[model samples]
Structure formats: structure tokens, C-alpha cells
Target chain A: MEKKRNMQSKELICTACPIGCRLTVFQDEKSENWFRVEGNSCKRGINYAIAEMTDPRRILTSTVKVTNSHYKRLPVRTREAIPKHLIFSCMNEINRIEVITPVRMGDILIDNIASSGIPLIASRNLE
Target chain B: MLNYELVVIGGGPAGLAAAIEARKNGVQNILVLERDLELGGILQQCIHNGFGLHIFKEELTGPEYAQRFINELLEMDIEYKTDTMVLDISEIKTITAVNKQDGLIQISANAIILAMGCRERTRGAIRIPGTRPAGVFTAGTAQRFINIEGYMVGRRIVILGSGDIGLIMARRLTLEGAKVLAVAELMPYSSGLTRNIVQCLHDYDIPLLLSHTVTDIRGKDRVTGVTISKVDQNLKPIPGSEKEYQCDTLLLSVGLIPENELSLQANIKLDPRTGGPIVNESMETSVEGIFACGNVVHVHDLVDYVTEEAQKAGAGAADYIFEEITEKIPAVPIVPQEGVNYIIPQNIRIDNLNGFLDLMLRVTSVYRNAKICVRADEKTIKEVKRPHLSPGEMERVRLNSNIMKTIRPKTISLYIDGEKTQYAI
Candidate 1:
């Protein structure tokens, strides 16, 4: 079908402003690394478009089981954005761990979780 | 009755910040009473980052933001009682509170700060046309369940409002393996921050349905489906534009109302617009010694603003106690005119003000290339040009002493000037 040969393009909304300008991205025919970004109003949008096309990352936030604490769950997060594909695998390793009571904020619970080299740290104190 | 210099109700961000500031201002014998078992209040359940961007100058999670203040309060040796519910506050600063450990207790204070924060609007408030089901939950309640209790609400969901809580929850649920059908918003535009829309929904490939409302729910015991319809300009559902989606959970992120039950009992004059106590530049309520801030004063979009506003109330209480405020000046009302929804500090005590005062307000609707004007004595005093304005985002204008000195009018009015421009996006 003609649809199968259609060049792949993606639409993204610029996160820089509340205006949220919709952007369209196309891979340049000349080079695989070159991208033609359209519909961005500012430099931040162009940067967002390029990064999204290349390496997209998201901050992972979730809760882990807590033992012998006032609360049953302790909130945890990656110190920085981890590779998007490793989120579920990271959750697998995170679920196996049980944090003890008297944990302070920024306490690294797991070092390089799921081989992403990003530390999963406690976001709150469980005293 | 136990007597103290100051008694702060609610040990959340506002109360804690107020208590700490008051302590630093030489006001001793302060007690912070909190109804929750923990001191941080709702911040404990909000596990998302993006808080403290303005205060700490770095992005921190909700709990991390509260912990920073909690750590500071700990070193100060400030007196606080958790699991203590304040029942009533009398005109004479008599606080009637009860706690399991202390039983029935009455505390008389020289000054009091009300920072009870706010509560989420539930399905009952909006009267969604549906049978009472097990799956209906407020976005905040669901957030507390998932983030605090580590319990997944449902496998499939249809969120009713695009509030920040709802938007954040959409991503949270999606990441946890639940399918979010769509985030239906009654308003045409999102009430949440722009970053939330991009990160929470756009990143997750979740659809945001604007100018849409849930017309019907088709489940008896548990939510099985929801019928959504495009809304008219009046916000009424269009009859023929209904579309149905199959989902198991229904989350409501409608809105929030400032918790002011004690304010009512104390007979503090409330501004009908803010749904909180009427306050002046000093954050002092009509009742001389009573002060209010944070959501107890008006709903704020950012916790950073809450901390800043509460510090004003804290300093106001300290000024009242330390005799720094010699006279209570007659206040000049700041009236909201065209394009302006409402403004905080409903009244301004120009004579009592030192340095500058912040006049925070929101617009009634979206505007572009609009100029916000402040007028007094039938003359324009101060004007600031804004590229765009929306109801979701609050705009703040600073009123310096020099401007106040120029205006001797009994009332200062704020309104929009210039032509309305189209939204670029």
C-alpha cells in the first residue's frame, strides 16, 4: 500500500509555553541525522523537538513498600530522567526492595536501577 | 485555658511557614495544631516533582519541599501538636481544639493564623448524572491511594477534569499499567500548568478532550463506561455530540474550595470572590488579631506563593504582638473591573504598608496583548503590559510605596486596557 512507504513524521506540542505550539518533525532526505522541524515559535521548541526525536527521557516517580514504619508506602524517584524503555524493568527491581523506617529524603535506595545508571532515591522521610 | 502568644491552625506549608516566621520575629509561646497524624499535610501524598522551583531554585518533589521546612522547624524547637483538630475559634482568640492525647483543650492566644488549606471538589458537588459507584474517586483521593497507600485504583479510567491533580494522576495511572481513556475538561482550556500538560499527558500519548463533559455514566456498582459530549459556549452539553467510552474508573478533578469552617465560626468577614476571609495588605482579617493565608485565604496555583503569602500573615501577627503596627489604618478596596476575575488583599491599608505590597489576581478569560491598568482618583496610576492572560494562571502586580504615595483615592481599581489579541497557538 502507498501508506507503507510514507515517510514517518511525528507531531509534538512544545512544553516551553502555555501556548503549547504543535510541531511537526521530518527526517531530512539528505542525512539520517538531519531533521526538519516546523511550527516552533522559539529556540526552546526547536531544542525540545530535536531532543524528542533523538533521546526522550522522563522523570520516574513511584512508591515502594516500607517496613516497620508509620506509613505503609515510601515515595521514591530517579535522581534524574532514566531511559524510557527501562521504566518497567526498573519498577521490577524497585518492587523487590523494602525500605526500612527512619529513611531520610534523598537516601539512595537503589544505585543505577535497572542498569540505567540513575539512582532511585527516597523523596520523603519515613520516620 | 492554656495561653500562648500565637496559635496556628493546620501544620501544613502555610501554618509551618507562618509559625517559623513568627518565631523568628520574636513571638514566643507559639503552638501549631494539626488534625492529621503527620505534620506535612497533603504534601505527603503528592509524590510528583516540579515543586520548590521558585523557593529552592531547584525542582523538588512535594514531600521534599515539605521536608525542607520540616527540617527547619525541627531545629527551631517550635511547639506543634499532631492529630489535634481545632473545633472553633472565638472572636477573643479562644481556640477550642480536641486531641486524643490531650483530650478536650482550650487555648487562648494573642494572635491566630488560619491556614487550613483546601479540599477537593467531589462528584457530589458537580452532581454527575450517574449511580453511586465504587469507582468514583476524587483525583486527590486517588493520588493519596496510589502514592501513599501504594494501591492501584483501577485498570481503566476516564478522568473528568484537567486540573493539575487530574493531569498528574493520568500519567501516574498510565505508568502503573492503567489505560486512561481521556482527560475530559469542561472548559476549553486546561486549568493546569502548561508543563503538566506536556509532561503528564503529551508524553504519555493520552488525549485531552477540551470543551467536553461527561453526560452520563453507564455502570451500577462499578464504572463500566462513560458518555462524553462536546459542551456549548454556555458549558451545556450538546445533545447530538455524545460519544461513549468503555472504562472501569471515573476520576473527578473538578476544582477546590478553601476550607473555612472555622473562619465562619469566628465570624471573620469573607470575600465572596475568594471564598476566604477578607484581608488587608498586612494579611490581617477583619477581626484585629486574626490572620489568614494560603488556601485559607485564597486558592493558589503554586505552593511557593502559599509560603510567601503565609510569611506575610506570620509577619502581620508578629507586628500585632510586638506593637510594631501602632494603628489600624482604614483600608482602600481594590476593585476588579473588566477582564479581571478577582484580586487578593481585597482591601489595602496604604498607610500601614511598608516597602511594597503584592496584588495578585486572575483574569476572567483568555486575553492577548492586554494591558493591566491600576486606576485611582479617576487617573491611571500604574500599568503593565501582558502578552497573554488566562483564568488558570494568576498574575501578580507589585504596588510600590511611591505609587501608593501618588494615589490618595479612597479606592483603587484594576482592569484591562488596550485591544484584545488572538491567542497565538
Candidate 2:
């Protein structure tokens, strides 16, 4: 059996302001994942390529139950980054978790959900 | 100083719309001062298609849409000054401007408008530690050079910020024979529209780097390379992952800041988030007789939205001629609640209610299959279901004024409801 050396990966673009860099990642066949990145022109591209290849993380967007506020529950995101492969898994755990307020911005509703360092938190304060 | 009924600064979409509306309302004396050699504002440089979808029902280029308003202004025979730069505006509606041949001239009006639009956030604002090179330019500036001036920015290019302009420029440069290295973004998602992602980056096989930020720039007189690093939750650069890309040109499309120097000088209160004046329902600012619209209020992703907002502002200025629409203290102030980033129209006026109230907002992150719930004082006022939601695109939620008038909350809050972020509304 032959061992694969170099691996290829695709990237998703999200500058949020307009410079969309959809980068393509290629990992070297040798050890250390001695990676060589192509496409991006800035330091941002280099970093994104490396992370996408190594530990891909994402911010989970969901909602928590907030009582005693203007209305009902409010939308929120995890303050911490979820592992690249565990995004959907953490989202599942987040879906199951809900909190009641008075919740403030950056309030942690759930800590280390599913053993991932990601914390389901409030993006805005709810009184 | 010459006195007039209204003086519109900048001959962009907002200014032209305001001028025409003022004239329609029977404001006899009107003056539109333009800083450029011609009347058209930034629209002249944006030659790409995707404009006038809402207004004309067809995708026209930026210039054509601007020309429509320009032609209408000419038809009305409104008094306008081209190559005129309005330097200052005092509290008394006095304007001072200068031109190469015209020298200095001062004019006064019963009402004045600031429609100066916005400027692109550059490398300095982002503080991308790098050598001061000549090759670096903003995405818009690069577009102007390549599209209108017919100058290739670089043989090899790297763009920062996955903005609409940056993405479009990537494709544009590819067509013109420039090798776009990649488009880098600090966030994990693309900020631009999904359509642009497919057409601009995907189609060209151009890579979009997400959750990444440029940490350093390399080169002396001109750009040679840059050191980039991965960002954590706080967007701080990660250590031991520094990598470099060799390129001649670096374009920054990081963001846009509303051109509000004059607004600030005029003492108009500004929203720190949008970088535009804190405007109410009528597009009237804190300062009396001073109004604003278009990109001068906030960076708009779509030009049609600018027209829609500007038209209202223009009409509002005209209405001021016949009626004194004094703003009453807003009963409810719209603020971000949860998972929400920010909302526009910082203040909401209920008196003399308009047909509908539109609230412009952006999310802090990405989500799918969600319902946006707008609340007033702990009671659900409005909720709308959406299939896909992302922070890249700005969301406009139009509330029924009649319905809004009935339910007034001291603080209007917005949140998401669905399987992931389900909440009781």
C-alpha cells in the first residue's frame, strides 16, 4: 500500500465586507503537514488556508430562551470557536440547550458544550 | 452670501433625488453643488451592472442609473454648480465652496442636505502592519483605475476583504489578464452576497480565505509579499502559523466608512456603528434643517437601497417646505437584541405615521432556517421566517406603521427563532 503525501482541500469565502478569498488548500505529502498555500494575497489568506487545513472552526448561530425581556427568546452565537469537524455536532448540542434571562451581551448560556471549547453565548443583552 | 430655498451637496443619487423632490414640492430656488468635474458622484466609476433593479426593474450599470437621475435634474432645469467643492456648512444653512476658476463663493439656504456618500476603509484603518507601498490600493480605487482609467493595477494581485467590489475586481482583473492570488477575510463567512461568491470567486477558481487576517506586509518601495495568520474567536492572529504570499499589489476592501466629516463639523449626532448621522424616520438628523441619505448614512450593499432611502430623504426635505414635521420623542428605540449585529434608523418617530417603517440591520453571524422576531416591550410585534441568513448581507425588515403605532415598546428588540436558536415569541 502506498501512503498519500500531498492532500487538497477547498475553502469557503467570507470577508464580511467584500474581499472574498475562496482559497484552495494543498497539504504536502511529507510530515508536519508541511503546507504550501496558493491564491490569497494577504496575511489573512495564509492564516485561513492553514487553519482550514488543520483545525477548521466556526461560530455557531442559534437562539436561547430569554424571559422577562421585551419579547421572547433571542438569537445568539457561541463566543468560542467550535472544531472544524464538530460544527454540526456542537450545533446539535446547542440546539438542545436554551437559557432564560436577564441575559447580557457576552453572557455564557452553556459552557464547553459537548466537550468542545465552544460556549453558547448571547450576542446582545436582554433585560 | 446668496440665499435659496434648498442647497444639495454632492450630485450623486441621493443629492439628485433630493433636488428633484424639492423642486417638485415648489421650492423655486434650489442649488446642487458637485465637487467633481461632472455632476455624477462615485457612480461614474462603478461601471459594472447590477444597479437599478428595484427602481428600473432592469440591471443597469452604475453610470446609466446615475445618468437617469442626472438627466431628470437637467430636465427640471434646477440650478446646479459642477466642479464646485462645498468645503463647509454652518448651523445657519450657509455653504462655502470653491472651484479652480470660480475661486470662493458662499451661499445660504433655508434647508441644507449632506449627501457626500462614503469612503472605503483603507489599510491604515485596519492597521495591517506592513511597509508603506505604492502598489496598495482600496478595492474601489483599483476598480476605478482598471475599469475607467484602463490601467492594470498589477500583473499579480492579492485582495483583502471578500466585499462585492473586491470579488468583482478579482473577476475583472482575471479577464484583464491579472492573476488574483486570493481574497482574504477575517471572518469564517463571506461578507458579500452569495451570488458574487459563485460568479466572482467560484467561477474563476479564485480562492476565498475565511477566518483569516493579514498580520504583516512585506516589501520596500512596492508590495512584494505579506505575512498572514489565522484568527481566533476574538479575531486575534494565531501564533506559529505565519505564512507569506508573494504579490505586487495589495487591495483593501476591509470596509466602508460613511463620509461624515462635514456632518461632524456641522454638529450632527452620529451613530458610531454605521459611521453615519443618527437619522430619524424622515432622514432628518439631530441638526435642524439638515438632512442626509444614501451611503452618507451607511454603507449600502445595493445601489437600489440607496435610491429608495435617498428618495424618501429628498421628499422629506421637500415636505419641510409646506409642513413643519417636528419630531416627537420616539416611544421605542430599535436596538440589537440577540444574535443580531446592529439596526439602522437609530430613532423611530410614530407621529404622523408613514405607510411603512423599514429597519435595516445586519446579523453578527451565520445561520440557516431562522425566523426574525421584532419585539416591542416584551410583546411580539412582528416575526418573519427566513430560509437562509448570513452576516454578509444586510436585512431590511419593513414594519407596518399602523401596526407599529398600536404596539409601542420602549426598546424594540430583534432575535432569531428556529430549530437552532428557537425562542418563544
Candidate 3:
């Protein structure tokens, strides 16, 4: 068996707290999981690193055009974090839609947007 | 004239929290007057997350955190007025307000809580020398355009002053496909939180130039570019270090000043440092029965702390409404000596002794391996070690009623101990 010559390592800053410890995640050649994290002050950093390496997510916030309301636009957000890859596409879909008046806070604008199983909910009331 | 037990001016997060607490504390007839179309104030435009960490123990977006309080306030059947603007507030607890439906309404309230939040300082306040340009917007104005109005302010941006709003906007404008050239801060260290510096700037490869100032702005109609230069120790521009960046928009996040014109009209003594009404341990200003809290008291780093402070003000207002003149408790003034910037509740009232009171303060500068020393009448009452302290973060110290009882009505000072003065060369 030939030995592996290179292992990839990535550096990230943990956004868990104000300390913002610089975290480094490296691919372990011998381990099956292929990832080991270091330089984190707490367990949250390790979890954040592993998730970042495997799959990343972000809470999307944007505005939707509204008609028949005092305000011209309505603020909306993903009820839960969605996959990072779908952010722009989700924004595109959200940009294409226009909501009517009498919207309440927490009203779902789109169900399972971008097939992410997260609904885009209204962030404020526009009556 | 309409009479109520309490009238809260401004229905932002602070006003909502204060009204809810006051209603819960037996002030049945309470009204919250909000000038906006809805209850939530600036939180509506702040679409990003990282709020409500301390109060809810979970990361929430601005609107979500605000809705939690709004739901609670509504569920309790508390009265509130949206789209109402308070014109004048008299020292005798009289409030005059106006709206479309309730035109020129007057109310004689037993107590009043001023929860009017802060406003962002504009370019005119800082006097950034430039031609009248359309692309120059405050960071919050840009945020409102992109986050709430669904309109992009510009394609290219340069943010001045690395406050939390500026840092967040750097990431927000980037996510919206705008090119952010750099963020210039006048101070040697950023006033924004450290986590924001990492996620907002470093993660996005945006440069944060500390000890930098925007010397001149270039543009006639829309912003064409800006000239930024390094500042000397005295914060004056260093001529040789000037550099230019081509950008369409220039965003200013210089500072926030408490909206206190109504407070001044009420003749409430203002704190020169905080730009807010000065209050004692009860959150009551020099004017009796009138309480103040939230950003109107002083700019806060977190909204949760605003809610907490509002609750204290709410409770204090309710106590004044319910209790009679049984006794007068002598209070002592809290003097900020070395390292302490300013302390809220400028005086510690010793009467109606609560179990504990929290003293909120901010340091003048950054320090390492330091302990905060609290003294009363020239005697050390308490000492607490803080591993790291910065001007950007607020420091809170809890004073037990027992410890406060031991001290007499004299001078109380808070200073830093064991502060490292110099770095090894």
C-alpha cells in the first residue's frame, strides 16, 4: 500500500463567543472519520468545526415585496438554519414573490423553501 | 384628560419590557405609546441573528426576540398605542400625544417611563468633508434598505467606524453581492464585539483598518470614491499615509446618541458622558415619578440588558406609585475613579432594601489581569477579578443589600487594581 503524502487542514474562527478562538481542522489519514479539530477552548468549537467541515448552515434574512400595505416590503427569515449552498437560490425565489397586506409575525411565506425543510416566516406585522 | 397609573413613552423593546414589568407589578392601568406603525422598533430592521443569548438562552434574530416580548405584552391584555407620537411630557407626570385617530390626547399619569431608544449619528454630526452625495448613507440606513426595504443601497461600499452595526453591515452588504473595500475605525481597537470582528470581517476577507480615518469623500451625485488615512496618536490625519479607494457608497457608523429631547423638556438632569438622563439606584431621575431605561439611559451592547434595565425601571416606577412616604433612605453617590468610564444609577439608594442591585459600568480602556475594586467610605467592600475587560464590553457587579447596609452615606469609588500598564519590548 502506498502511503498518503498530503493531508488537508483548514483554519476557522469559532463564532460561539467573544473569545473567538482560532480553530484548525485537519484530515486524519489514519482515522475513518477523516477530521480532527484543534485549538478550540471548548467543546462547542469542536462541534462547530466538524459541522463546518462536513456541512455548513446559515440563517437567511431578507425582505419580500408587499402590496396593499403601508410598508412597501416585509422582512422575512428562515425559521431554522438552511444549507449554505441554497442561500442565493432561496433569495432568488423569495425575490420573485410579492406578499399582500394583513400579514402577522411568524406567518409562513414559503413552506420548505428550496427543499430545505425550513419555512420562510414573516418577521414583522404589516396590517 | 385621561388618567392612567403609568404611561410609557416609546414602545420599542425597552418600552415594551418596561410596560410589561410595570403591568405585572400591579400597575393595572398602563399604556405604551409607540410612534411606529407597530410595536417593535429598530429591531425590525436588524434582520441578523445573535440576539437574546442571555435572556432566552438561545440565539434569535432581532424580530424574534422582540416578538417574544410583544406576545407576552399582548397576552396580558396590556394597552398600547401604535402610530402615536408623544409631543410633550411635563414634570408633573402629564403627557401630551397626537395621532390620526386620537388627536391631541392628554393624560395625567401617576408615573412615566421614558424608553425612547437611540439614533445613529449622521455624516453631518462628524462633519466628513465631501460634496453632497446620494450614496453616502448611515450603516443603519443601508441596513434598512437591504434588510427591510428590499432595495440595494449600492454596488460598492466603504464603512467608517467599526461599531457593531458597521461590522454587521460589512457582512450583510457582502452577502447581498456588494463589494466592501474596507472598514475604517478611528480608535486603535474596534468598539464592536470580538466575535463580530471574526465572523463579519476576517471570515469575509474584509480589511478592518484601525487608527484610520476617512479624511475626505469624493463624489458629487453618487459616491465615486473616498480617501482614508492613518491617524496619529492625537487622532489627527497623518498626511503621508493617505490612500484612496474607489467605491459607490460610503456608510457611516460613527456613533449613536440617545434621543433625549423629551427628557430635556421634562427638566431631567442629563449625564454629560452618557447623553442620557441621570438616575439613582431606583432608575428614577432627579424628577420624581419619572423613570428612564434602555438606550435612553445609556447605549447598551445587548438588547437583553436593555430588557433587564427596563424591568428595573418599571419596578421602580411601580413602587413609587404604590408606596407612601414611610421613610427616607439615605443614598450615596458612586464616583468613578481610575479605569471606570461611567457608572449607571449614579447613586445607590439604601431604602426599601432589595435583596441585591446590579451596578452596570464600562471601563475606560482595555486591561489584562485586572480586578475591579469597590470601595465605600474609604473601605474596600468588594473585589472581583475580571480576566479580560474592554471598553466594548459592559461590566456588571452585583451589590448585595447586606454589603450595602454596612456602608454609610459617603463617597463610594470603583477603581481597577493590578492593571498592567506596559508591554515588554
- Leading candidate by DockQ: 1
Q: Show model 3 residue runs off by greater than 4 Å.
A: A1-8, A24-39, B324-328, B418-425
How far does residue B315 in candidate 1 sit from its true spot (Å)? 0.9
Per-residue lDDT of B1-425 in model 1, one digit per residue for the tens?
Answer: 99999999999999999999999899988999999998888888889888887888888888998998888888899999999999999999999999999999999999999999999998889888966768989999999899887789999999999989999999989878899989999988888887798888877778999999998888888888999999998999999999999999999999999999999999999888888899988799889899999998888988999999999999999999987884557789999999888999898877777898899998887787788899886888889988678788888988887668666678889998756544332
* lDDT leader: 1
Q: How accurate is candidate 1 locally (lDDT)?
A: 0.87
In the range B268-360, model 3's lDDT, one tens digit per residue, is: 999998999998887888888899999999999999999999999998889889973222566688888899999998886776558888888
The CAPRI-style docking tier of model 2 reads: incorrect
Pick out the ten consecutive residues of candidate 1 chain B with the lowest summed lDDT: B416-425
Query: Residue A32 error for model 2, in Å?
Result: 49
lDDT of 2 by residue, B1-25 (tens): 7888889888988888888877877
Model 3: lDDT of residue B137: 93
Look at candidate 1 and give me any clashing residue pairs. none
| Chain B TM-score for the candidates in order | 0.97, 0.93, 0.97
Per-residue lDDT tens digits for candidate 2, residues A1-127, read 0112334545444332233444556666773556765556567767765765577655444444444554344445556556745655665675565567676556777778768866776554444
Docking class of 1: acceptable
Pairing residues by index, what is the TM-score of model 3?
0.92
Give the candidates in order of lDDT, highest first. Answer: 1, 3, 2
